[model samples]
Target: MSDEKKLPLRTAFAVSVSKTAAALSRATGRGDGSVIGGRLGMMIDPDLLAHLAAGREIALVSGTNGKTTTTRFTAAALGVLGDVATNSFGANMPTGHTSALARAGATRYAVLEVDEHYLAQVIQATEPRVVALLNLSRDQLDRAKEVAMMADLWRQALAAHPKVHIVANADDPMVVYAAGAHPADEVTWFSAGQRWQDDSHVCPACGGHIQRGEAGGWACANGDLRRPSPQWTLLDGEVVAPDGVPHEVKLQLPGTVNLGNAATALAVAAKFGVNPIDAIPRLGSVASVAGRYAQVERDGRLVRLLLAKNPASWLEAFEMADVAPTLLAINARDPDGLDTSWLYDVDFSPLRGRQVLVSGDRAMDLAVRLEINGVPFTHVKTFADAVAAVPQGRLEVIANYTAFQDIRAELDRVL
Candidate 1:
């Protein structure tokens, strides 16, 4: 450890404290203390800063939604040219940085996906070269504060870096406005061009009117619109090379939202010089993003797990259901599914004719929400009861982060 580096005394001490804490968590099976991977960065911040000073470059992606898939796609797209590093597994915090650091180890280039709240904190400490702004939506209301609060924090993140490239989503008024003040080369707008229409109206930047175009892209009357020529375009439900290679991605988990996530991944990954067209074949190969649209099949029946961590995602997932399927919605303890306020924000009328099985720590709360909305559902306290309640048709299990794990455990038994 002494020969590791010429680390400052404070950094060395912090590293030791982090290592000890990590060890205790592992020994007690409480945690590796690296959920978001932040603690390790508290120690390694000095090292990451030194790397930046030495002229190394960094590519980072952060947003309220779609980070995991984007991170994975970015790494794959970039990995074509050289070795790449990323938090594809949701390790976007400091201790997660330690894990990333362990793998990246002089890889020279990195494309990391991080939490919106932690983005500014890490960018200030690490000074990454490119910061991809995917979009902002109402997600994780319990922990992330608000979408506007995140946008404000983003401005502070931009200030710390001399060179910041924002790959903004043209459909998101909030993201497009963040690009208006920045240079054209420094800012590029990405949109799916009619594939996905964002629900957010009103300009997050100017309080001006937002109008939708023929291709489903948005713009302001004052010319605050998605630029025509972007470094990357989220067009046609997948990423495409200008030559029409059709990075032909196919995500079987269902929903246009997964398609949107692919589009964002394509835009950011292309910027890092990965051939999007080549990666399309592999998107379907990733069957489950570990409960976030992850799929599992058992006993001649299939259970597609859609981790609806918030209202926006929940609504999108509900809209994505196919063939009038049976659904199971669970409310768990994670901040991902807390503050069911977003429940009232959505229209549950589509669920009127469908049978919904509700379960989780707060299953009664969600069940009540469904009842008030007149959506047909059965409330169950245990996963077994919920599984038994639903008929064995094409079952869609949409759970909050933690409940996803719970339902997935039972899926093994009854699917």
Candidate 2:
């Protein structure tokens, strides 16, 4: 029903082939098929994304963490408008993005979760109407640039594309510096409250020490940098709008972190003409994002999946864990980040005084960290073994990237 332009003959052929490849890939159970389809499309036409995204309203979500969840929330909130095509399976890169758009059909709106490193390329190709900059921290050190370098890249990208309206997290110094690079009028700031300040101690502007005050207040030693007065603020578990009205947000997902994600999504939704009251309830209806907070029943046991990829996310995940039996899985796969040194950065103190089941390829490494933290843990060889070790009641399972996917796949096989 969209008035969007039709694809060129060659590009249309590429899309058909890609869709057929994706169908075959899904039927064969080789994986999600997003990557294969997108790869083949790109092989046929390097500009496949531009063709697919033509005449559509695009919104891009980018950050070090929470991009997947925030993209889901933003898409759900925008659903009040109409059909929103999104890469909900966590395929955020160019190939996956191409696949998502290629299959979007007549959908006129898209909410895309973009990799932080590829934000500039995607923005240039799609010419998104709104861009959500969540937060920045060290992630995938082996594959990603340094935090400062990423900030600089974002600054340059925003400066180059001044027409794109930006919704950025003001609480994060790196995000502040990056988004602040654009014309101030083009940016709308939101403070979701930073729980992990260990990585943001130094001011990105002046390299001076950053100060954190009580109740999410922060200032920099140098006068050049400080937390901006956010247009949207999450105060006391509610999102406060510019009109000084508080909209209570209840999420099926757990943790204060999800509250922050909701606030960010609301800001983006408002930019797209959705009222905060309408968008807030739509965001709260999101039960789970991808497999992040999914409650799966396997072998007569309820296992809740929680994902944390870095120290910042891990700190938040630990806060959300219940006192019930817990399973911690860590992997050093390419997707999970090979450098396990970040394990030491997390305060595993909450895990103390509880019997923790540690499993994954890097279980022993986590065991050593837990031992030093004085957390009682048993290192299991397999995810099934770890699940079996937990008592037969409500259980919590937290894992890094690859481990989380493997556990979900294994559960799907049996359940």
Candidate 3:
């Protein structure tokens, strides 16, 4: 109400109308309405997002993978200061950001998940206090920009906003090159171990081979490009702060990838003046992120959901998955990237010893890839069939974007 008084009359009306539209969208069972509402609000007032973000203590989380989960972590850590508004869902675009800020109305702190490609646009609008650069990899090749291009965009954005502190992953060469655009004092580097080397083998600064060290450091074979020594590091479930104080990472999300995410969150929280030791418990409280690692009961069997959008995320998901009956779902829909060719880049060997079932709109494509990889799998027609095809005690489901949403909806209906 106090903030509304500061808004121009037309912008205030646009906010009200967008809220009504969002509520109607929810009533009609369309979706969460975050995107639609924000779209409408921006249509009325083109600068609605910038206006809403003007005075907030904002921190943005962006990357090819783990944006949603990392944003959740940052919000929870910042919750130590006050009520932190965030996009809990996977909506990371301008429209989603607009809706979130509009709904949260006057929250002092806001942590927003930003899509990798839209990082520059969001940085300009939010002018956040801190920006967390997670990692870069080949994701949605048909739709999104290449990793190098994204890194370049980030570099330009950071160069323009020298005042904003950058919390960067030092293990990722792409991240290092991009965040290196800022002055060293303004950037806080954290090494959490980058699992996917498929995208970062080449030096972003020069056309050279990036030689990765056995200890997780790297250097350019042709030039001076190399991994920066991190102020924060996540090594074997322990997060070491800049002062060399190590805090044990106790996370419910499962796997080292989530631990890496926790490290990034802690660094961002530290920039916001929250003690890293105090934020550990808040990070542990995040059990599931937008249905990524949720375990649901189906016919007395626990079904765990793990979302993997690209090869990089799939590798992490495989590590988090248990040695149980695993269901792999792939969709070539727009949201899931119409090209299913990225499946070739992923090594599905982890599921070789377990009973595997494949299902989705692109089940045939997935089956062919599995066949080529010598990974045995059964092709099922529907989610129910996939569930019944394997002996049910504990089942792990991995799906990309839209397919993941579909499975979650089906689980809601069935159980």
Leading candidate by TM-score: 3
Off by over 4 Å in 3: 1-7, 413-415
lDDT of 3 by residue, 1-415 (tens): 4566556886888788778888888889898889999999999888899988988999999988888999999999999999888988768999999998888888999999999888999999999999999999999888789899999999998899999999999989999999987988999998888889989889989879999877997999987688888998876679888999989988889888888888899999999899987888999988888888998988767899999999999999999998999999999888888898998999998888889899999999999999998899999888898777777588999999889989999988221
Cα error, residue 154 of model 3, in Å, equals 0.9
lDDT by residue for model 1 over 37-113, one digit each (tens)? 34554545546433422344667788766777667766666666677766555767645765454434467677777
Kindly report which residue pairs in candidate 2 clash with one another.
none
Every model's TM-score? 0.82, 0.95, 0.96
Query: What is the clash count for each candidate, in the order shown?
Result: 12, 0, 0
Q: Residue 315's C-alpha lDDT in candidate 2?
A: 84
The best-first sequence of candidates by TM-score reads: 3, 2, 1
Question: Tens-digit lDDT track for model 2 on 349-392?
Answer: 88776668999989989999988988888888887887788777
lDDT of 3: 0.89
Quote model 2's TM-score.
0.95
- Which ten-residue region of model 3 has the weakest summed lDDT? 1-10
lDDT of each: 0.63, 0.87, 0.89
Which one wins on lDDT? 3
